[model samples]
Target: MREVEETLAHNLREVREKKGYTLKDVVKGTGYTEVSISRWETGTRIPKATVLYNLAKFYGVSVDRFFWR
Candidate 1:
């Protein structure tokens, strides 16, 4: 479970960066703070469903892609 969580975080960060979005951009788009994004990316915290939805919309990707391949 921990490994899967970490993988999700890593993939999320990779996708965000690949799209040229900064933490500030994510915050602006998803209304989540930079600290939260940092925590999520570092696997220190798990994002809530709403937040994940917002992130997926902001990145124009499916929420499942953040977890699954």
Candidate 2:
């Protein structure tokens, strides 16, 4: 469980970097605060389903990509 969460966090950060998006950009696109996004990236907080969906849509990736390899 912890491993999965860490993977998710790592993937989220990786994807955001790959897309050249700043925390502010994600905040604007996902309606989540920069602190929340930072927490998500650091594995300190897990996002709810709706937030995950919004992130996936904003990043142009499937939700599964956050979990699966």
Candidate 3:
């Protein structure tokens, strides 16, 4: 639910930052727009499962790690 979505966003944002990627960089990696990345980081919208999977894969992490502790 909302908590899981928030966790996903938080983890994705953290991982992106740890890797020194700007939102624009993530957008290029995910083929999602910079606005979409911003929305996710800001908790404005939860990304689709496919988008999440692509992001996790792009970061070389499992989908489980993207949303869970």
Candidate 4:
């Protein structure tokens, strides 16, 4: 993965883990499919802006958190 993608993937996974949530749990909370969240966590796909915002809000984190990690 590219550096930015890697950081985002890592941060997403880390935050989810820290919150004790599974991919399925995120799906329920965000109204996104588990497959899509898994792809983002694996750096296989980047979320669109709205999706990213939803995920950030779901995780109670700022969007910048994904980039910084």
Best lDDT goes to which candidate?
Answer: 2
The per-model lDDT (C-alpha) reads 0.89, 0.92, 0.83, 0.88
Candidate 3 overall lDDT versus native: 0.83
lDDT, candidate 2, 1-69, per-residue tens: 999999999999999999999999998887899999999999999988888899999999999888865
Q: Please give, for residues 9-43, the per-residue lDDT of candidate 3 as tens digits.
A: 78889988988889888877778998888898778
Name the regions of candidate 4 deviating beyond 4 angstroms: none
Which candidate number has the best TM-score? 2
User: Cα lDDT for residue 25, model 4?
Assistant: 92
Pairing residues by index, what is the TM-score of model 2?
0.94
RMSD of each: 1.0, 0.8, 1.3, 1.3
Which 10 consecutive residues of model 2 have the lowest summed lDDT? 60-69
Screening candidate 4 with a backbone cut-off below 3 angstroms (N, C-alpha, C), the clashing residue pairs are: none
TM-score of each predicted structure versus truth: 0.91, 0.94, 0.86, 0.92
Runs in model 1 deviating more than 4 A are: none
Q: Compared with the true structure, what per-residue lDDT tens digits does model 4 show for residues 1-69?
A: 599889989998998999899888987887898888899999999989888788889889998888884
Clashing pairs in 3: none
Model 1, span 1-69: residue lDDT tens = 998889889988998999999999888887788999999998999988888888888999999889875
The backbone clash count of each candidate, in order, is: 0, 0, 0, 0
